[model samples]
Target: MTNFEKLLDEQLSTLCFKPNEIVEAAVVEVDRHKVLVDVGLHTTGELKITEFMVPPSVGDYIQVVVDELDDGEGNLKISHNEVMVKQQLDDVQSLVENKTTVDAKVVEIRKAGLIVNVGYLTGFMPKRQASIEYVEDFTSFLNQVFKVKILSHDQIHENLIVSHKQYLIDEIGGEIARLEAPVEVGGVYEGKVTGIAPFGLFVDIGSHSTVLLHITDINWDLTKAVIEDFKFGDILSLRAKSVVTSDNGSQRICMSLKHMDMSPWEKAKDDFVIGERFKATIYKIEEETGNLIVSINGIPGVVENKDVSWTRMTNSNLNNVFKRGQEIDVVVKGFENKMGFESIVLSHKGCQSNPWESINEKFKVGQVLDTVVTSVSEKMLFVKVEGDVEAIVHVREVDWINPFEAIKSISSGDNVRVKLMEIDSSERKVSASICRTTEDPYKGIVAGTKVLAKVESIRVNSVHLSVLRKGKKLEATLPARYVNTVSRWLPSGEIEVGCELNLEVSMIMSGILYLKPDNSERAQSSFGTGDNPFAEAIKAALKF
Candidate 1:
């Protein structure tokens, strides 16, 4: 026999030990088949090779429990492997009941489970017990130690199942329970990226657990690229928006990176006040309101096209001024809760810088000079004013013999000198007496003269009369009725927006002259007492 076997025989020669009794053994000679263990008794004990935790070569020390007692000399034989297996089974059962923690190393991988070697024993860590996440590679965890909880054990089948994920969770859960009550709504946390999906990212923050950082939660600038660009191991700071537990006992956490720092609106408050102006560019256009959605830095607001005054231009022309890359000075109008901040009303109208700034710039009121008719329409003729390219005049304002007839004869290439009559910058329009160049028939009529007038329109109790005027406008009354017939016309006649009228000034009050039509052909009747004459005349004429 080997020296170890001799030592085991000598140690057990006097003592009578029973099987299933745990006993301490002193180091002795060890081998592949058996170990000569001095069981600290009168005689040494013999430990079988299969009883070792693993296949021992030599010089390795181990403890074992006696499996059986001898008949004659009463020597004990111990099983080291069986003792370890039983200890692990008891430990795992204790963990399942009390959730105790055990440190274990990954030894080998089998079909559906990991062979874990706890300090005292070996336990099975099935795929389901590995992690909450899916495990793609099992070999990567070889020799790695983890705090594990024994989940289940089968004494009859000699099987053990353990979970490392649950062990961490139970211990961490205790720590989390000791932490403060509820998480603040906008509280921020530092976390690691656990996974990535097309729609969002998942982050792990200790007890904050797997918080979701949606694609929208990323910084506005990086939202589009965050999905494919972010790595699995990236660490990011995020804000917790909400937390809720699911029906299945899983925790859900909503997170945001965009608001992890200061909100853009709050930061914007310091940069832009109520009336401060800034050079802003249009970032986006809203088709519904015809408004430009503009952004300063990351702060967003709108500039309505209607709010901006653009004259002497078309919509397409206005589009050029506020296009994507175009910038303009805008005053911060005001903040609207529903509409955000309103900014400076933009205007492209002529001001001091315009070439028509000088009131006394060469051209006189009656100085008829030659100029090309750049634009001619049915009612107006736009002429290039003097040598000044910026100034122009309408046909009515151009001293012409007969502006109406004269404008018809003029074309785009025709040349004419327009006599400037009035220049009022406040109204932004010019007035000229074109008839001064033509014959003024109205000038010959005295202030109180009874002139022949053609009846142009009929009202409740009077008629609108017209005499040839200087312009295309034939003089007429607004209500076109007798002073007494004002109230009657308000209800009866459906006066249209565009209609012809003629009248004589009955009286002028406050420079606003009152007028009555000259209906010399009709006989006079009592006010409101006679049948509605206009209606009666219409019915008589229709005879329907």
Candidate 2:
């Protein structure tokens, strides 16, 4: 072409390459100081052999970056270490971006986590993310190699973040049956202690699921178990007890270290004497059920609320009265699992003297005793005697005037005197009366006294009245035998309140005023067992 075009072509052909550009180089010759690599240049580029993690042989190819276009000898300056670092950074970036997995080796153990070597850089794996299970001892994992997923990374600072838990999730997936077959329940297996809780020990049984050695299942005598007794990393021979499938379909394993031996359950059955007394050590007081799990003669037993006291103390109150490790006197009652405990049944109050004993000698019928009202029901008053004896006062015996009102008036814990009506030691019952201790309200009232009465309330066969005699109002009831003289058997529903009655009191017996027509001859006659038409009619009515 032209003269200038010919000059430009000669200069362009003489130029070698740009600096910092990555280029693939092949080793042509190796020396002690440097490696001679040809990068398709006129003069071969040189690299320090020390820059390589592994020394290359002749004709080996490696990727390198151009450090300088010229090294004063017309050879290009290149670095294998620098390009290798850059390539690793690119790989770490890809791992971080794609969230991929890579094999890692634990290099150092830190209090917070683990320092691991992944690819060409070191990354931190936090203690919580180091495993699917809790990691209390990191020394077990030192120098251990496992796969991990990149959590975060800083290429500028050469810092990498990884998680062993994430790798386990993606790898193991926690599918116990799919990943590995779980151990058979009731079979013995070797387990390692991973954690220690106050109530139990968390064990690693080589299954994908969890295995726990509960405190209650640790030993027959539960008073000796504490988390401090065991150390982390202690390997134990545990027998699998139960395997429960959770709602999420994962298996939860229950193992016991004590089950490796013959359980005391077999030997305990022959040791119980049905009525013998024993000092029991309380172990666990269940807060929800208030059931006390006790150890008696080194065997587990249960004391229900019913057996706590003859007074029927509730299980809820057992929590308030008893605590773990407290000793109580009890008797071997029986063997039953009524309260969800399959052990000897014990009664705490059975060892004490029965309050019902000698009850007849302490108080006889018609004897007045100072009592405390324990409870008031509609028809009965439950009272407690001085020596923890229970006595009941029927509603009819509460008051001669009004018993319904007396039930409301007598509250719990009220002190009152009661006359014992019946004291039967065999039945363990004390029948009492409140009004019997005092004089009858109808005392000294004559049977033939005439009174102005008013109907207060009617019953099925009698009309109850309030008699105002000499300015004092007194309760009275018309005898059903004499009600027909004025009422002709008045159906109680048709009777009205405040209905005035012009009648003479034929009799006042047992706090009831027997009423009759003032004009009837029977009203004027003696109301007793005599040859009167009224008494004869009463006999005829009774016979009917």
Candidate 3:
């Protein structure tokens, strides 16, 4: 190497020197990037233009700190950022000693204090000393412009401490204190999300204090979402739920979005009704019941698996059917308590069952149909037509010459068309009719009636009477007065049968008919006769 170049290599060394180390060099040239200087050491040292307060022109006098050194095999390594930081720290130290304030820029964030640029010098601002009111987002001030109070400085490390909030706190603490003091239960306030933790978030609610936000306080939609969906420095409107004081008298504020607002249960009650259908989203598979906890318009409900096949079928079939943010349809079953919504109960199955199931629509009264004769008795026919249902048609209800003839013609297996006479849902039975499907004939019959009677039985002067037929015996009546007429006459077995007579139906009680004889011709007989036949008949018979 040439002599000048050889000397230049040695001069480039010792760029970093001790404190207060001074060096001189010729300003060979100056540029925006750097200035070439012949420090006249072993060779010459160089300084970047950024290191200088003012850029130097060519051939101008320039002074540079001998901050570091390196052999010319590589360029000298030096930092103007540190040198400028040291000078700024010295300036802030003087201000701290005098208790002065100056505008500054936050340079670095650390656990203990903020390194700030005060008057283009460095300073340290401790967290507590930063403000009387808490500063929620201190990191946002990094490289941000602000006015700061000079707090303290360290000479050895050349650290300068400053606080922007301290100056502002002195100006605004009273107003913020007034605003914070009157907060009551259920009172709401605006806040910003400043910090996030496993338990909750920390929010600044304009109270000069930061309040904790429990995870449960977040909206249901955001609660179930991953924690990463939100970030620090987000602003939110928080509702105050409680304010508790520590044993030391430090007030701890609790906030929520759900408690101060309408609960999901309350909202569901107002928005939905029983049997109403809605769309829903499946939140998760429950660990205990393995049911799907679905959200019906944000209300949660369980879809319990009715069977094992159903549970398994849904697994593969619904692999893509439901997921976070996926929408679905559901019916509101009922209400239940859940999460912060203490009244939020829900159901997805109650809508399936309806009141229409119990009403029988196919059957009605007064209808004729074929029926199976189930039982036969002297007075009635019991039959079943539809399934196991049984109905009875009385023999008196048959339109036949006599019950015997009706029985002979109507066998047990005969398909007889009958009318559904009556139905009682409470009794779960039907009454039918084979003869009186249209109207009941005996319903209009009067109690008093005179008719020709036949002596079907020889019971003294008493005899069974028929309206027209004598031996057919469709219906018969017994005389209430006949007992007296036969009292003194012949014995019941000695009385003649097949005798002609006159009878009146005196009165009918219940289903039994009572009859009285109208003729006095029987007075010659052994039977007595009077206004009642039996009273006089025995006297006349004794005279004969």
After TM-score superposition, the amount by which residue 41's alpha carbon in candidate 2 deviates from its true location, in angstroms, is 36
Residue 162 alpha-carbon offset, candidate 1, angstroms: 5.9
Q: What is the C-alpha RMSD of each candidate to the true structure, in Å?
A: 27.4, 22.1, 36.2
Candidate 3 lDDT, tens digit per residue, 162-253?
66655654343312223636456577787666555665776667676777877656765433634465665566676677777778866777
Worst 10 residues of 2 by lDDT: 486-495
Evaluation by lDDT, superior candidate among 1 and 3: 3
Candidate 2, residues 198-279: lDDT per residue as tens digits?
A: 6787766777644778887777666665667887567789877777787887787778776676546656667777998889
Off by over 4 Å in 3: 1-26, 31-34, 38-45, 48-56, 59-63, 66-83, 92-185, 190-203, 207-238, 242-267, 274-277, 283-295, 298-321, 328-343, 347-544
Candidate 1: misplaced stretches above 4 Å? 1-14, 24-29, 33-50, 53-62, 70-77, 85-103, 107-113, 124-135, 142-209, 214-216, 223-237, 240-251, 261-544
What is candidate 1's lDDT per residue for 52-165, written digit by digit as tens? Answer: 545654445566777766646666656677767666666566667887777878989888889987765667898766764456778888888888887777677665678876
Candidates in order have lDDT scores of 0.56, 0.72, 0.57
Off by over 4 Å in 2: 1-185, 246-248, 263-265, 334-342, 353-544
Q: How many residue-pair clashes does candidate 1 contain?
A: 14
Better of 1 and 3 by TM-score: 3
